[model samples]
Target: MLHPILPLILFAFVATATPGIATTLSTASGAQFGFRRSVPLMIGSAAGLATVTGAAAAGLAGLLLAMPSLQLAMKIAGSLYLLWLALKIGRAGPPNLDVTMAKPNSFFGGAGIQWMNPKGWAMGLGAAASFAALADGPGQLALLLGSTFGLTAAVSLSLWCVAGMVLARLLKTEWQWRALNIVLALVLAASIIPMWRTV
Candidate 1:
């Protein structure tokens, strides 16, 4: 049982660390706003991941997957939000590197992204499905999966943030800043494809 569960933890780490909507957003946020302002986003993303994992353990994933309309709605809403965020990132100007002039991505915004994110759903569902048999009870299984996901997500997201912060130093001029923003925006836009396919 422990052996099997250990692999799931590794899976969570790999999944969260992989380039996806959440990681892309975290990187962009860290680059634009720095580490301090991005803390809430990281925390919120972890919380949201835990919530999704719990929901999956409780069998909500199947219900959501079965309902095509609900899945479609989520995909549309998530994609639109990502596009809006991309627009904001693209238009942003270089601010005082120490003091962010633009509003940073908030806790709710981070959580909301997970709520609508299809990859998040898939991860939760996969975790729950994979680990359900190891626990003594459904509640225990849910708690275990949720905690595993939450911790991995927090760590992985923070790593991405740190990467962005390091890269932020490269934007010496306004044009460099703009160019980085455009690239981030393009990456965000490209993420929509996976979301669309997941639904």
Candidate 2:
């Protein structure tokens, strides 16, 4: 029981810390708008992940899994949204850097991405399932999982954003900036494919 509980925390940390859609968005936002402006994105993403964890403990993740069609629909929807975001990120750079021209990714946008992603759903469900420490109470499970993921997500995403900020300093020209954005956008788009490959 102790082993299971301890491992779950490590799982949550590593899973959230791994670069994914949310972190990609954070990186792009940090590069484009700097850390202060990217704070909302970080917070929103963490909130969104917390929601997913709580809902999984609440049983919505089981409902999604029981209905394959609904799950597929969600995956498709999330992928489409990410693709659209990738396009927007790719197109935005120094020429499009005017804050008025292209505002940073918003709080809601970050949350929405988490809500829609299959990877998030999968992680939530996995964490919520049959853990010994949480055997006596679902509420306890949700609280623990949500809090763990949320904290890990915030720290992980902020690091990625900081990495993006650091990368920004290396860009000596508009073209370099644009190229970096394009590369990030491409990686973000590519990230979606792995979740579906197993399906």
Candidate 3:
């Protein structure tokens, strides 16, 4: 049996390190909306991840993983969506940089994105299987997976927020921030190609 804690640790590290749409959006939100507004978005992202991982633990992910064509289709669609997001982010105008103008909808929006995210589903399924296989009991496995995912979300979102804050601090002008956003967007878009190939 695999060590339950081991899988949890793996999942946490993997989720935290992976730079996905959620991370980019969260960073943007933190930079544009401030930490308070970004919190909701972070919560939403976490919720979505938990939903998918829980589904994987329930074995739904197996059905998806079983079909190569379906998996391929999902990968393509996810990659395309990510590219679109990157483009949109790149083209967006600079924000007013006022926290009071911050839109909280971004948090829930990110959460919704996680549900349809191929990367998220793949990670969730892998973690679920790994945990289920090594767990001595269902309860222990659940606990481990939950804790891992929760911690991953917290750490990942915080890092994104910090990145945004750092950028905001460094770039004082609207044009500078706009330019940075474009770079961020392009970097995100470029990552999709490699990830798609790997998938």
| Whole-model Cα lDDT of every candidate shown, in order | 0.85, 0.82, 0.70
Q: Give me the candidate number with maximum lDDT.
A: 1
Writing each residue's lDDT as its tens digit, candidate 3 over 25-106 gives: 7787777767887888788888777776666666667787678788687677767777776766676655675333335445
lDDT for 78 (candidate 1)? 90
Clashing pairs in 1: none
Candidate 3 or 2, higher lDDT: 2
Q: For candidate 1, lDDT tens digit of each residue in 81-183?
A: 9999888888776756423337788898888889888778887887877878877876887788888888999999999998889888877898888888889
What TM-score does each of the candidates earn? 0.93, 0.90, 0.78
Candidate no. 2 TM-score: 0.90
The per-residue C-alpha lDDT of model 1 at residue 81 equals: 92
Q: How many clashes show up per model?
A: 0, 0, 2
What is model 3's C-alpha RMSD?
3.8
RMSD versus native structure for model 1: 2.1
Q: Residue pairs in steric clash, candidate 2?
A: none
- The CA lDDT at 54 in model 1 is 77
lDDT string for model 2 (43-132, tens) is 999999999987887678888888989878888998998999888888876634544327777788888888888778778887877453
